[model samples]
Target: MNMPNYFELFDLPVQLPVDVSLLTANYQQLQRQYHPDNFATANDNDKMVMVQKSAMINDGYHTLKNPIKAAEHLLSLKGFDAATEQNIIHDADFLMEQFVLREKLEDIESQDDFVILDDFHSEVFARQHDVYKQLLEFINKQDWEAALNQIFKIRYLTRLIEQIEKLQEKQYAL
Candidate 1:
């Protein structure tokens, strides 16, 4: 079966950092066109087809919405396989930095001062932003390995932030 590429489906240029306004407009238009309710009176086979098409459109919209997902999709379209398990980050310095950050996050629970936790959260956010900047550079150069490494860093930072937030909630409940 012939399937439209996500960029083509959304009438977007096949590139990173897509125009979000155009994507949202095109997504809404596609939803309206393929909405199953519009085919309520059709036969079961046609309804099923519409449901599948709607699902595909929704999936494309979501994938293009998130930066990391969009980068991965672009890489896949360019024939890059993200062998994440095999493609370990080899930058020893970066890994050491990550180790230090993780150690700080793990030690947060031992601190009694809420101010320290707040400062740590801000620090992690700044680091995450730095990772995002690095990711953009790698993506522009089509350096899939470096980009994936940055993606991994961002995911870790995201989880770290969530853990900090959960701790804050628990502290507030006390």
Candidate 2:
């Protein structure tokens, strides 16, 4: 059996800035067609095939849905090995900023000021949005270096956001 790529499976162009609504609609249609329930009475082989198809469809949807994963997939298609090259973030300034951000996150427990936490969260959120926009631009240009830098920043910001949420949960539990 021939396997269509994620973009082909979704009937979309293999690029960034996808139409999410259209993706959702296409995914829903594909899911309905391949849902295991539809093959309940079929032969074991047919049921197994349906199960695999469903898994592929779900994986495709999620991979395309997330900007980071989508970017990595696109890079791979363009002959760039993102997974192997991921460790080299060439922006020293950005690395320093990340270090500072991590330090602030570590200090969160000692800082009793909720306002400070709120401000930090807002700052990180804004930075995350900015990085995402920058990432899109880099992806559009196929500028691997810039895109990788932004991806690193976005990942760090995401982790920081998760940490912030955990801290908030702890505060609320008090």
Candidate 3:
């Protein structure tokens, strides 16, 4: 089966930061065009095709909506493999920084104060934003290696932020 290029499907440029408003509009258009309800009276084969098209549209919209996923898609379109298990981040400094952040998160988790958790959440988000900016710059320069490294860092920071948010929720419930 031939897979459609998501950028082509959305009439979008193959870039990191896609035009969100345009993407959303295009997505809604596609969704309406291929909605299963429209195919209710169609033959089985045509109905199946519409369902497949709708699934692809949903997948493409979600993939393009997320920055990391969009970056990976862009890299894939450029013939670079997205992060695989083999593509380990070798930056010792980044690894060390993540370790430090994890330690801080643990300390905050042990504390009863919501203020510290909020502060940690902010710090993690700032770090994630910094890495995201670097990823954008690297992608613009076509520096796939650096961009992949930044993707890894961003992934780590995202998980850390999620953990902090979970802890905050738990604190709020107390």
Each candidate structure's TM-score, on Cα atoms with residue i matched to residue i, is: 0.87, 0.88, 0.93
Better candidate by TM-score, 1 or 2:
2
Off by over 4 Å in 3: 1-3, 83-87
**Candidate 2 residue lDDT tens string, 3-106:** 34788899998778777888889999999999999999999999999999999999989988987878777766666656776666677887898899889877
Find the candidate with the highest lDDT and give its number. 3
What are the per-model numbers of colliding residue pairs?
0, 0, 0
Query: After superposition, which runs of candidate 1 have C-alpha atoms over 4 Å from their true positions?
Result: 1-4, 83-87
Candidate number with the higher lDDT (1 or 3): 3
Tens digit per residue, CA lDDT, model 1, 41-141: 99999999999999999999998998777877776676665544344667788779878877886787787568888899899889888888888889889
Score candidate 2 by lDDT: 0.83
Q: In model 3, how many backbone clashes occur?
A: 0
TM value for model 2? 0.88
